[model samples]
Target: MGSSVAGLIGWRRATRICKTFLFSLILTTASGAVAQADCRADQVELRWPGGQARFSVELADDEAERARGLMHRETMPRSAGMLFAYETPRRAQFWMKNTLIPLDMIFADQQGVVTRVHSNAIPQDTTVIDGGDGVQFVLEINGGLAKRLGITAGAELRHPKIASSLWACDVE
Candidate 1:
């Protein structure tokens, strides 16, 4: 009787361990899938007078994400950028505090038209770079790319956020 009872306890213990392991595996797999989907690259296009440039940008639409924008990163690909979207049009300001790499900040309106461009912002500088009133979106790219590509104030930005408005996406 004693042996039978001990065997039963061991079996239950083993079952519980197996269950915990399986649960952990499932949770890890699900979290990986979610991260992969969220990190998928989105594209934005900038159209100027005689040239156009396309970039793969990560969206920073939420407060927490925007607050942590590109800080402490040692390097960023020239073709990649971060797009900050706002709920409404208002003046915007950006600083390079804690940012390890220099960047060019492009300020755009609600319609995705470029309103201002702050080029070669010094890294870790706290000075505010202001986007004039009615600015709704801000795109940050590697420093000097704006000048190299000839992106100016008149350039128009096209992304999903502005596609529903005046700058509609070419495709459905």
Candidate 2:
């Protein structure tokens, strides 16, 4: 029948070009995993020792968003914060049970410096709050705004998950 209708129209045009290249490789791998999970909102900068502050963070790096920190937020916006990222410098601990507000944890190092702050905390207060050793980023903010923006203990955060950060992030 005319070479079986030209081999059934070349097998329906090779199955429509293999379903349009598998739908454009699944939409470019789901938009690169939604741009790496929305690159966590960033922007940190602390400085201190005379003063300098600016927050707007929110990164929680993983392990289920740092075990769901800032639990049931009732309100947290005095410039806003919540960092947590840890991949090495250990000895960081925190608690505030179900969280509900009051914070100020800080603690850095891994090059982000700061080392420890702790402050306010009490709000559901489960107590723990250590952050000693070499730490590795923690920031929480709001409670007393890290001693009303002095952010002590050698301060100097400037984020982007401190890859030796002394204030790195220009686009990494």
Candidate 3:
């Protein structure tokens, strides 16, 4: 009888240890995922009714970079984009010119709210694609991606530079 009681206690102790180990593992995994998903300076995140999306981005915050745009790039990664930042809200006009890949332009206002999405602008086309007035930021991605991802006029953009973002960046 004594031996049986010891065995039962040992089993209970092992079971408790197993449960504790599993719980710790779950917490660690959950926290790791959250940490990995933290916002990055070179990344932009957009959210809409359809949920959210992330893109690795190259910033065009200066005059020279914004003027050059995405010109001469034959290929861009699927989850990558160019983010154009303006010092203040103003009308933004874009033309394809020397750009090789078709693009989708997402224009946002001062609050990081998307104001327009121009889908599938023809590659190398010289026609101006006006992003309208009060545009503070623009995200250029591969053509047709905006429509496919449900990125629209009302979506919210989150980036480190968007100081008044409705969707704030965690890393900032």
TM-score top scorer: 3
lDDT of 3 by residue, 1-172 (tens): 9999999999999998787566334323322352347677798877776456778899999999999999999999877899999999999999999999999999999889999999999998999999999999999998987876678999888788887636666643
Q: Write the per-residue lDDT of candidate 1 for residues 31-50, one digit (tens) a residue.
A: 23322232223967666665
Candidate 2 residue runs with Cα over 4 Å from true position: 1-29, 36-73, 76-81, 84-88, 97-123, 129-135, 139-159, 164-172
Cα error of candidate 2 at position 156, Å? 23
How do all models score by TM-score? 0.74, 0.27, 0.77
Per-residue lDDT for 1-172 in model 2, tens only? Answer: 9999999999999998787556334323422332233223475666554555556777888889999978998997667788888898889888888988888888888888887788888988777988888887888877875774456888777665676535565574
Clash tally, candidates in order: 0, 0, 0
Candidate 3's displacement at residue 100, Å, is 0.5
Model 3, C-alpha of 57: deviation from truth (Å): 0.4
Error of 1 at 46 (Å): 0.8
RMSD of each: 16.4, 16.8, 14.3
Q: Who is ahead in lDDT, 1 or 3?
A: 3
lDDT of each: 0.79, 0.73, 0.84
